[model samples]
Target: MSLFTNSNVTCPNCEAVVNMPAVGSVNADRRPDFRDAILDDSFQVTTCPNCHEAFRLAPLFNYLDVGHGQWLAGLPASRVVDWPEVEDDIDSVFQASFGANVPAAARDVADLLTVRVCFGWPAIREKIYLKGVGLDDVTVEMMKMDLMRRLKDAPFVQGTELRVGAVDDQAFQMVWIDAETEDVRQRFSAQRALYDAITAKPEAWAALRDKLSDGPFVDMQKLFLGQGRVAAE
Candidate 1:
């Protein structure tokens, strides 16, 4: 079941406080419109009654799409620096809800879910978009690593990210955007062959793949964020 709780929020534009329904969890299988809203970037948008300023709430909830084989913990962008701790918490939550702690019946459903921890809107949206388009996310992250090395003036920086804005058979539409503000810093296309090449040579990327897939936070950025969480045995 999808759950929402009314919470007070301060408007960024106006100093007015307003109450709104904040999502606690999303069951996309039951409410696909919620999924649609998320894809369209409209989920949890609220208008301040006092000043009528529009503001979006940072995602802080669990999203489950059984048919898509995805189970994600969506968190605020500010919390990404603490991913090690956050990943541990998400692991515990997944365990209680669907891992060993759950009944066998639930475990059957859990087996199909690809668990992930995403920070901010762009990060979470990229995960869902890649799944919907049948793209391998691990390879996609590998592509970003390659791009960082190849692009002479790539705008790689803190609080910004490279995400797949769209994709097709020929190429992936990529955007380097501010994770918090959703501002597009740059736009470019990556050929499908780049992803295909990486997919074809898994042996070369085995060690990096292990590190990226060590936790639910399978993003390449984790590599730059100091010594990350130790890989599970």
Candidate 2:
């Protein structure tokens, strides 16, 4: 079920309190629109009426994607009222919605189910964006590691950030932005040909299926690297 609650938010600029709608809870089956909003990267924005300022609102909510059989409980550090009972609460909510047949991805809530802890709006946005692009979060992290390795020899400024951008049939675009100015520094494309070729193998596909069944995020760096690599073998 989709749930929303109004909360009084004090404007950082004017200190004027305004009641705003915050997502109290949500599930994909019950509220696919909320999932759509996140996929569109539109859920992080909230505007203050009095100050007329737009700011990011991080609310505690359960993100359940039935289509993907994925469930995420997002808890930003700033809003934690009770830390002790979080596990029990999350289990209760999950059981209430999904009953006993929980997905293997979240079978062990303490270890694998919890995705974000003390994460900001951007973190949430990145997860949704990557998922939308049919990529695993851990795979993206490994990709980022590879990107950093490639960039180690390149000439760049001090506060530059590299992130995975648009994914296309041809390539995956990696965007480099200036951290201080938040300006696009460069856009580099990494050809998807190699990835496509590797995953085309039966072993690779089976490994991926097993990983996804285990959890939404999977570190496939080892699977694709070394003499013992799945692709090479």
Candidate 3:
């Protein structure tokens, strides 16, 4: 069932309060239109009536894709609390909704879904898009780190957004965007050999897997770097 509520929202542009749809939950298979809106980033956004300014209505929401057998709980990062418990609650919800058996690949509840402690909609949208392409977010970050290291002496600034645009068995294509300005810097390719190296290492895969149980913002770069540091020691 589709779950949402219309609430009064204050326009940041003109301060006129208006009612808008605050989506909290969605069963995508039943509500295909809602899923389309989410992927296109239109569901939580509303235009202000007084000033006609567009703004995001970022209430925490749960996205369940029945066809893909995936789910994501998106919460504001500021609401720091017991996330593992929150995940457990989501697990219970999933079981009640879908029954006891989950996919064999899903070894546990953490594997059953994704927990996104998001700063805003863009990050959440990107996560959804990445998963659609069968690329794990943690592994993609690892690739980004390798790209920066290879171009360490280049003129690029720090904090550029590394996004996977396409992937194949031989290579992964990425687009680099300036973090602050949100401008596309360039497009580049990262050898698939880099990705293979990480998945091949049991320790690295285990590091990412273990961190999934703790909380959100997996911090793949930090975890990957920590592994590298340990290896060098």
lDDT of each: 0.91, 0.56, 0.62
Candidate 2 local lDDT, 1-233, one digit each (tens)? 77778888776668888787788766766777777776565674677887788665565776766555466666663333332244346657666655567675545542323342213343455566676677666545545655556665443544454556678888887766543233577878887764555445646455455543242223232233233212325
The global Cα lDDT (0 to 1) of model 2 is 0.56
Q: Which stretches of candidate 2 lie over 4 Å from their true place?
A: 77-118, 152-162, 175-188, 193-233
lDDT of 1 by residue, 1-233 (tens): 99999999999898788899999999999999998888888899999999988889999999999989999999998889999999999999999999886799999999999999999999999998888888878889998998888887888789989999999989989999998888899999988899999999999999989988988999998998866766669
Per-model TM-score, in order, reads 0.96, 0.60, 0.65
Candidate 3's residue-wise lDDT over 124-231, tens digit each?
Answer: 556677777777777666666667778744435444556665678898877665432335678778798888787788585675566543445543433432222223
Off by over 4 Å in 3: 77-119, 145-193, 203-205, 212-233
- Winning candidate number (lDDT): 1
| Ranking of all predicted structures according to lDDT, beginning with the best and ending with the worst | 1, 3, 2
Considering lDDT, which of the candidate structures 2 and 3 is the better prediction for this target?
Answer: 3
RMSD of each: 1.6, 8.8, 6.5
The candidate scoring highest on TM-score is 1
Query: For model 2, what is the error of residue 179's alpha carbon versus the real structure, in angstroms, after optimal superposition?
Result: 11
